[model samples]
Target: MIPKVPSSPQAISKALHSQRSKTFNAFYASIRSLRQTPVEPVDPPSPADNDFILSILRANPSLRDTRSYLASFGVQPQRPKTKSEAQLPEIVIPPPPLPKTSPSLGKVSTEEQHAPSPVIHSILNPVYKRTALVKIQGPFTDVQLDSITRGLAYLEKLGMVSVIVVESDDVPKGDLEERQLLIDEVMRVVTSLERQGSHARPIVGAVVRLGPKPGAEESNTDPTFITPETHIFPSDLTQIRSSLRAGEIPVVAPFALDSFCRSVRVDANDAIAGLACGMVEAGSDNPSEDIDLTPLRLMIINKRGGVPSYARSGYPHLLINLDQEYHHILDTFDPRWKESHPHSFSDLALARTCLQYMPPSSSAIMVSHKSPSSLIGNLITNKPAVSSSLPHALLQGNLRLTPHTPTLLRRGLPIQVIRSLADIDQVKMTTLLEQSFNRKLDQEAFYGRLERTLDFVIIAGDYAGTAIVTNEGNPGSPDPISYLDKFAVLPSHQGDGTVDFLWVALHDESYGLGHPFSANPNGGKGGKGEGRDLVWRSRANNPVNKWYFERSTGHLRMGDWVLFWSDAEKRLKIEETRRGGAGLSFIENWESGRLGNWAQVIPKIPSSWK
Candidate 1:
């Protein structure tokens, strides 16, 4: 007979949280052990407790490797008992070898061309895979279930997956009988192709819990029964990887805590995280292995897959690169961040560098927070050629806020702020401009003008738009000014508030550098008494002038362009010093810094651009 069920999704969420917390705690502990830097302070040893366990540890010797609770706070390994042992220096275990890499994606051997293919590891290659992790999410209707099955079948076909692990713990709030049904349904769909005579081996291993015989709970008075904790069996992962290597899929239904003595409550995420940490530990020990032990990526699929909880626009996702910051990211979500367990999606996405995990070079993971339908094409589509396979395309639009609002961004988009021309790779920046303008920029001249020293570069929407702000004067100059060298919004997003946002953000950013005659102590750092007006130029015929006039203090048509400045000031004695002679040389000198003639390449004043 079936047990009771939760009536709503909220009820299921609560039940899932309670059951998974224990497992998650354990997984978190395991990750902390492998982290390079301690996430939290290690408590000092307790005097009395240390003496008691240290003595036992000293007597039993080999018991050191087995027990979880011993002299955890105080005991150090017992000193050598024999003379030879005492004479030995501290034994240093060398690190494991790194993974072997090929120049590109080349064959291990020409003769075994038909062998199951795995992604080739590329060292120093920015876009190649070092590992891949898969996360299968649930809560599907019959139709969605069919789509999921097809997606899995596609993976089985491409040989992209090493193994697919679906355990009872992964199923939402349900009884043992319901959990079994869930497992069976997943296996049948995944292995449907096997019945069609396909070479794929979808269901090869089933790991179910055993033992903890009745009355075992009565015999054991473990504290865990009161407050459950995460527990991962080494055998589970060992068996899972083995099955995959032998071309079999493993579905693990881990035993609930040994303390519970019941065949209920499974935490799949706890197990998955445990497996990831284990592989990291093992791979660290043997980096130069002929065979890869861990999957390159470990994905966690739930309601929204890998999408963030909130976004300012549609098409939001975060493709996190877990290289150096994985531990930091894990730490935030690891209970220690706020000293609480992660119970919701917001807590899970806890890091603000976007955390980088310890996958080998060129390896990265993408947490897709969208729907399962998105995964369908990514899994089944033919492996497309690299980026160079296509011609370059034009890009425009810019988003840069001084005090970064990290949460406001879409997923998988990485942003960098360049403070100076030296901070950028000129060749690359020039290419970006070429695309934005749809006309090639003079590379040498662009680089030379960049010596004016850019103050900041804000690229948002993944280089779709950018603003190049430059520092334009010597401190001793009569009029020191900050110039907006280039500001372009893509034709597509011209009036979408991108320009307005930048204008306000840049103004505030400049104001914060300190202003002339302002009592706000923090306001006027730009060069007190030197200048307060921020200036730039636009084409005289450009329609954007209408909008510029509305915002600027004043504008003067100087030949091809109109010189615009914030209304905070009239003429500056210092600006006149810019060229000694008249005829708008200051404006003309400012315009000379850019490559490609502005009049020839710039867009006409569209209503929206204004």
Candidate 2:
């Protein structure tokens, strides 16, 4: 018989949590049993059948309606016909007559039930194509724990199996039991939610602990640190693989066993690295021979959120090019902070190390507990929470105020800079521009002017994108004025931060336009004032103006074009004029001259579009 649920939702929730220890195994076993069950001819409902139906209804109250309630038993009730179907002659076949003595809840024939056929469990669930290895930094409050539980359920709904590694960095080394208790508490919360059917798709949580390697030396290193000898692997992944194939989310505690079977505290990041290395070793490198589950994502959930940006205070880098930016990010951390909190450094190292073991396509995400949905959002879109293409300076309101946003780290493509225009591949450039703008390039005219004015070009990933800057200063004009001639990215790379990389390369001092440049109205050479002034013009109706507005200090619209310029003094003058300062006459003269007399040179620049 179905176990009697308490009178209310609160009571039911209480009962589930209270009976967690006793019901945990049985609850998972019931799911396994249901999956293994085979389809058979329909028969009159027995007491056992009634109990099963009642159990399902009580488990998920959302299936209270007749159609949904019947769906649980693999039965679909006839639906009402639409206008099209109603116009046709409808034939109604009543359910087979029930015997007066039959103990049936309702009539359900074999024709009405669409049950699944019997097959081996492996055939039912092949090696999952997408799996996420998640590491959650613990010592969570009740609210945070609940958020994580919901986050895991969201991952399941998105069709990715989650393998969680719980971090014990917050727990003291002397208290090994507390670490285990934390793991147990996590499982308990997951179990209670599963029992209550809080999520549409059920998520079952299982605990798996790492075991020490045979003949490995006893760990004398500190529990908090990750030493080579202290690191332990899931030597035999039989248990982990089995749980995954069975569709269970394995919540692994960082504690492991030694040769003597004593619990050894391991660093959570090391545990993840160990798992990553083990996965690589267990599977073949060749695609045709590989049968292991594909490790698609690595997630780090903690309070600090994604990797911090040393340059931009109170914000995380939206994307990290591990190949290029890893060393830079590591160097940016203060020596004192690294010494005080080693785990912060270790986590950054872990992302780079683990990604090297997985496929080139595999990436990592670091998200905060406050934004659990961001985990699902990032996974679904495979993009950063804040777009890199947006102007960082212009970001305001919540996105700017919120420090803990998700960051995406990948083994991204290298940026290639060609200083001399002679080195650029014209064919690749043509193809990229055509793909990005959906327009044919007038190569002869484009190259004709570029031959004289081209300052430099930055290519990303074999011409997936390019940024072309040129000197647009009038002849005999002493100051060099940098003009963005063309900025285009292949459609495939539009949102993946290729534009940002190209933009960064455009302004990098090593290339040409010196960043942190000084603004001198005199337009003559001296100290920082010698740095080039930057300006660009876009069509008045172009969609990229918002992005331009955010990065540029000032802009003015003309007949069919809008001119944007980056200069500190000019920007302040415009703001001052807007506030009714004495600069209004200067603004009027600037506008009357049409972008400080750029009208003389901008129209002279030949259009590359046919």
Candidate 3:
């Protein structure tokens, strides 16, 4: 009475027998391997095999229930099959007898037994409960969904409560089936973790999209989402404020600071302070200001080579040049110097004195000057002159002063002028001179003159020569000749008894007998040579000079005067003379220790007169 079968009974029976034989063979092989090796292999099932098995089970309706299939195969059910079987008393077998144990392998010491397992606790664990609003813009594929699920699983392992906030906009249009598949995968992962006692909470929620307002494009419209758990709303301000108040640790994300600040309704300063505090707490040594803008003073002394010649010379000519140019510009701008001639000198002297006494700052630098004219041109152009052009080391030459002969100018003695009181000290003077000169000089010569004279030493260029006073005298001595001896030159006119004339003139001026030299003509010589000559002659017959000479009679030996005159003649011959009185007349007698009348001799003017 059974309905006519589509296939013959014999054919169906044969097919079933073949299927059963194949299943038995597979099971028998597996059982044999397990029996042979008690320890099971740790390898996971191949992905292909797993997929195939899953596909077969899904396709076969009867095999969908794995428990029924296992029962048919005579496999013991996880739970007792019948009530009678479950109610039966369980029979427990005795364990095998223990063998004699070796002390080293079988017996563990108390210390070893009590020792803790080397299990590492992860700091990344979500110790603090926090809810983050993650807005995922996507039409994710199955693989992508799986990846996201895996990531959530990792978070769950670390004790995090993860929830997926799903929005309709996130699903692809006309892909409802695929979207469902994604949801199913997510649900699967959550279910699997829950069954395994993991706290993986996957949530599904929708985001409400507001239509664009006014002329804005629809794409530009933003969607708002809700998160009820942890009370962490998606509003940027709320999140930031909460983070600040709670002292929540900031996630390491590349978020825009300005945007973040605007969203949080917090000032940048507050954020910065918080960040600084956090950094310090985290053991960072840097200050907040430093981190914001780490400043460094980079001074690059641009030398031709890494090691400049000026540096080797121990003079910073480049620095000096720049300083001098600055001073010159200042002088030009200063109204006081322009209005009064005497005031200008006083100002210059004061400046020089200040420079002489003061020590250089720690950051002083030295450089070389190869182009002298270019440097001077820059100065004239009101541009800052570099020290490299006038290296101070070049000032180490001898500075010689010859009286009144303009031809001796080639000797370069007149150009040796010092600008400061520090210029009086040999070491400082030489350094300054070398800077001005931009060339290396004889250090011994320069330093010796500096110590010996204590008078300002003159600076000279590389090709430009130098001279030193040959006479020896104590520092600060009042003798005019002694004082003059400190300088490279003395101004004396040969047969005119110019020394006597200068002495008389100086005395007269000091006593308010003679007028001061008419305001220096032609703005004075601008450079070293012109300046030196002007200063020498201007002061030679100065009242101060006369007073110094007259008052210093005891120190002024006749030999000193005679030596002064002799040296003066060697450098500059007597060219012409105008008799003030009988020539060679004894104006004063040293042995008598009194002012005495003298016999007059004829004045002798040299043939080399102009």
Candidate 4:
């Protein structure tokens, strides 16, 4: 049964603070029961249902006589056509990624939703064949050529990677020199395969330049949009499947940088990522086991390991043959900040050329000390994308993030302060959480929750790697307490001082620090919290409990919630009062945890929103 509401704020306050033993449990039991209140069968008159619409028309009788009103205006109704001329409105929310369990042609799955590290499902499963898709930076010098040849030999020896994709877009710039260079490289690779002693030679083909798709660039108002350049745009991937089907390696062709001669450079990272995505769209196919076995691999090799040693955020791709004019333009921006944040330079036209594009995926950008083939062997033989012993830092760390125990943090990445969920890029945020939590978030439900309950949200690193401090306390209470909600860090970035950064930032926010970041840049900041003391809860089985317990001044175990507090006095008071059978308000806060209807959208997504 639903509990009766107290008539006034004073009555509610008195009941909340009541000393009677049964009052705490009775109130809590009622609150718990309140959550279970039988919802009316909404089908009859839902906001958009026919009954509701009819009721609205009934309330305003004039609105129901639209036909007569139209007749007075000399208008007449007509039968609907097979298809309405009206285009369906543009979708605000991007579609969810393809399912990893059963990926189809051209469909790539989000890494966060799949296994912590996708070491190739083909390894254990007999259903899919292992294949290699190499996207290397072109016009290589003698040294790079030797290294690539040796790398291919090494990969072939392991038989873990087979198909190689050479794109024409990476060809060197010139009237015909760039095009010739690509053709020559293809011949070189084909020759190399034939000369090698009777090993299974990979099927090679050159994919032509796949430029912007039909009517795609229209919605792109950002004069600065670089998605098509960095990431494989989904619309044009069918060409890749066709090339693959014809036993040809798809190569990138030269794209126009201007009306005449200038050509865009090749982005090896995006090339590899793009071709692999094409294979996904083509769907998995059975390979001939009678010959060589190879898992699909996308290889990018360069002097600098695709990523810098330190972490930074931007589209993933390497710039090739930078000209003196372009170099002069790049000189304007700080080299350091430019690497960390590419969005800083989208305004400069020449600098714009430097941007490389790759879509968001579980593609981990790492600095490989070993050769390409050597890394392939390590990948096939070992698991854990970033092994504990190896000290190599992952560049573009957010892409490879999965919800496993994080490795210790090495370099301190910057934390971004977000006051409301609206300020966030919801699509990107949703993608990151889906991967982190390994569950799908209902798009509308996620937005609705944020609209009503979101108060404070903080993100660390390129993607959201932290929590939302919400559900602080009920109205009328002097100190309602705040919650640390939906806290998360990529396993690779954990232990690398991320949590410590978060702890200090939140503490400072409540302790008279500047709002740090502007709230909900989408709108205005929310009402400030009056109370300085904060409280949060964690599940009992969470591994992060040790980290929470050590940092927290005190804690309490109530039901399934193990509440922790930064305030020493408050923590002890709750602990002692509860033991003595004296009433406390902390229990109420626990009841309120994850209580909103919107909360279900992201529910217990991850443990310890610390």
Candidate 5:
């Protein structure tokens, strides 16, 4: 039988503090229980059942109805027909023409002079093949010839199996007035192919004219000089018929050329250059992979422990302290203030300013010490009224100005509130970070050991706080840290760096560092004091504590290097330790004693050093 436990505040606090200890004992007990009895595997679905479901859906006619009775059985209704399908009419075909009378056999033939031409019948037949004729009339520049060649090459590659080119002189050239007549002939061919549906493939046949060969001089001695001219036009109907019969996609030289001309008149060289630029833009011809810039959730806490406020008293001078600073923390983090001080500005300002350049898709969440009730009340009260004058301030200066009607904010998805650090335990914080990072902790014994070592917790979400629990094995222990680590929080409370630490910790065991358990694999023999290593080692010895330490360390290392925002000194110390160097050393005489060996690798201290 389970023992009864009190749910009083004192009992709860004790439980929260001893979360890690309780979690370890519970997990150990669970593993022991699991070893005694193994679980059975689930059975797979039968093939006959799958086939029956598919057949039932396909054969059911009532499934087509929007409010179909089949829906009662969880079957989806078929989609309704679209407007295009309903509007289209069925196609109709005309009867074939009657045969002509035998004029030669009868003395006075019954054949009519106005009888429909055979060519017209052939053109109307859907199965008949038709060809597009093209002609090019030019003074014959090399560029024009090259363009035509390229067009022809493209057509050949597309498998227009029957393509032919002829010289302008090969056919009778028409006068300028009959140019329309030539275009009409070409349109007729295209129309014929359209009527043929998929049976016919359109062909582009061309005839080109060279006005005169280069380097051939004109006769200067003639008394009356005649200027040579180039004219490209379709030949008469007779010539078109002859060309058609010859199986050449009909062409009438220069005029036919105009029909084949495509939009965008650029040479091959320009086309190649444009392609090269596009390839470069597409990043070396490997199809561009999209960059994911998912927004990060950040939990901000006032290190000073309380909310800062500012009020104007009767005094003439304005006072500044923690109160005033609390309201302005957002402004300090904003990128604008750096511009006001030009002389003191450095690369740091430039780096901060770069954050503003990120695309609109990127986002961040800021949490403060505001009470949940106050925050919710403020949100409801501030619902926008009919505002003509520059809508009510969207953000407290420097905070990203999200719209008041934002979907996330309106849904109460932004800020989370915690009254104090004790409200959240280390396990919850670790779990929050892990969920944010989309990581799963290593399930191996290493992770189990690390999990029991975590004592530090950060109360995140919109409003942030830090909780440090010392889980000593006790009867009034709080919920197991393992349970707390599985809780999911609002997206805004999840900071990328915070989540990154959890992810790193989860993976840190493989790296042989970061987590206390993983870092000191020899069972915690490194340092004995309450120094950083010792703090890490003590945490690592407990499974949960080690897990939390590894996760936090991992996050710290993987997170962005926002110098001012992060603990710069702590980061430096960690790096030096990892590199096997002493942390924050101030050796007076490096040439003597223990420092002598390191002195050989170290350069002389700067002369400016006191």
Candidate 6:
């Protein structure tokens, strides 16, 4: 059987290469040799046939039978997985809640508490919500009619809503019919002003009869005289607020209703005070409703102008600090002046009373009918037309003085006078002078001069301002010449009327440490204490010369300096006339000698600067 094994190389090659049986015959012959089993060789498939079988199997769709056949050869198939099974599930997390806050430690301030909410309309919270309560004393003259209307129109333009009260006190104290006539006249004037103006806003007259203070007697009160109990009841608060909200200027007449609800006369000052107090009280009572109606200013537009002072030689007081000088000014009024200056007394009294009930920031203004425009000017600038401390000589046409100058009033701070320099802090004094002058000071020279000639020093409000006066004349002269040595006000306190306050102290005869002069101008020890003949010199180029020139009685120019003096001759003429002095010739000679002495001594005074 597996007989005749191919032993020759040629025979083996022939058997391997033959297509009938490839390598199978050889493998079988070898197996036969090992086990002695008889096995026959089989034919192998052709390459072309194997290709045809693979193509046919791939093309056929119904190949289920082929899978079974492939499984016999140990083959397995895999199914595709879905997207849901492959991807991970998402888990969302919300942000942590906002942390809770604790309440604030500080309380809300008065201004902040009264501040209007954002939701409030412009009508409710106007651009200029601050009110100016104008109390017009007496009827408007033909000349004042045009100016007052113009002033009111200007106030409207400046965003101030005016509430005018026409006082009928000056009109002959008559019955209700007369009061009504005065009201109509005021209405006519207001209408004329409105028509003459641009007529952008409507001007209306409100004829409201005011009521007396609660729990007070209903007895008839004179509109001309002001009493402590005189005040308007706050029944007209709603009417005022509503009118103001509507952007109207209310011209109110001063008439009050009695217990029987009949119209009667009440003090004009009382009406003004009541309206002001009502506005303030309304805010306090219902803070949400009348929040924006608080009056910032009370303007007493007087036809007679500001309060005049005999101490100022018939010049009006430009400013009044009611807290300290109220009684002092009241005392200065001669009993004889009561009839002549009735309006002056009433205006001053009214200002003090009205300011007492108003907020501290509020102020009362008294301006002349000659310059009614100053009402809005004062509101815009919050300053007087002139400094209150100007000398009387300057006011007498020496400087371009305004007869219509405005008078400002407030509850101001107290002034302190130090007769000796030893009491003042030397270090603070030096520092203040340096700051005010914006230059270095010769401290030794200044202190040395002060010690030798220091008459007195006046300090205003914690050394915010200071003035030093010195004796420049000979020790034994009949009229010891007085000189203004130094005047200094801290730069921080400059524009807020500190210098004016200091000037008031320096010229105030009552504040002098030496005997006050009844007619003498020199403010020196044991000299004519009746006057203020203060002499001082300023550098030729000093900017303060303009102010000096305005306040000085006379000035003379030297090479590098200008000599200025407030002499008794020009200023004390009124006093002399009041005294009916027949010794004018002798006094003139003595004043002439003092002037020569001042010219000689002022040049020898040492400079307090390096």
Please name the candidate that would achieve the greatest TM-score relative to the true structure. 2
lDDT pick, better of 4 and 5: 4
Clashes of 3: 31
How close to the true structure is residue 138 of candidate 5, measured as C-alpha lDDT? 23
Query: Could you tell me the C-alpha RMSD of candidate 4 in Å?
Result: 24.2
Ranking by TM-score: 2, 6, 1, 4, 5, 3
- Residue lDDT tens for model 6, 1-610: 2224355666544543553232332232332232222223333333322222232222231122222212211212323445884586755554222212223424434553344222111211223345677887766665676666666665554456677777755467766477667667667656755664423222223323455455434442534334344444455565676666666676666666556767666667766776766667665665444225667678888665666665455556677767557766777666766664567767788777667667665667887778755664465444566666665444555443454566788755467767887898988888888998888999888888788888788777767778888887654486567888888888776545566666766766422223222222222232334555778888999977887887786788889999998765434665467668653453554455665666778898888999
- Candidate 5: clashing residue pairs, number: 35
Candidate 2 whole-model C-alpha lDDT, 0 to 1? 0.58
The CA lDDT at 417 in model 1 is 52
lDDT of 5 at 147: 34
lDDT, candidate 6, equals: 0.59
lDDT of each: 0.38, 0.58, 0.25, 0.39, 0.25, 0.59
Which candidate would rank higher by TM-score, 2 or 5?
2
Please provide TM-scores, in order, for all candidate models, with all chains considered together: 0.38, 0.62, 0.17, 0.37, 0.18, 0.56
Candidate 4 lDDT, tens digit per residue, 1-610?
2235456666555543442222322222222232222221111111112221222222221211222212221212333433543455644643322223322223334543433211122112121223455444344554555455545544443333344544433454454676566556666655554443213223223222344433546855646444333233344455544444443333443232322434444543334433444444333332222221122333443333432111122222221112111222244334664554332222222122212221121122222223433343232322223332211122224444332111111223445567766688887777666776666777676666566656677766677466667654444445444556666666554433455445544554442222222111111222133224455677788867876775564567756767665542333344556779765555455345423422332234343221
Expressed as tens digits, the lDDT of each residue in 1-610 for candidate 2 is 3454445666555544553322322332243343222222232233322333333323322112222212221222335666997899967654322222223435444543433221112111221235678887876776776676666665554355676777645577678466566566557555633642332222222222354334333533324223232333444466666666665666666655556666566677767776765666555432332124546678988876766665455367677777666766776656654543345666777887777667665678887878776765565455566655443344434343366777788866677667676888899999999899899899998988899888777788889888787887654456456788888989777545566666655545222222232111111121132234467889999987777887676787878999887653334444566878554444543335446557667766778999
Q: Which of the predicted structures, 1 or 5, would earn the higher lDDT when compared with the native? A: 1
Best candidate, lDDT-wise?
A: 6
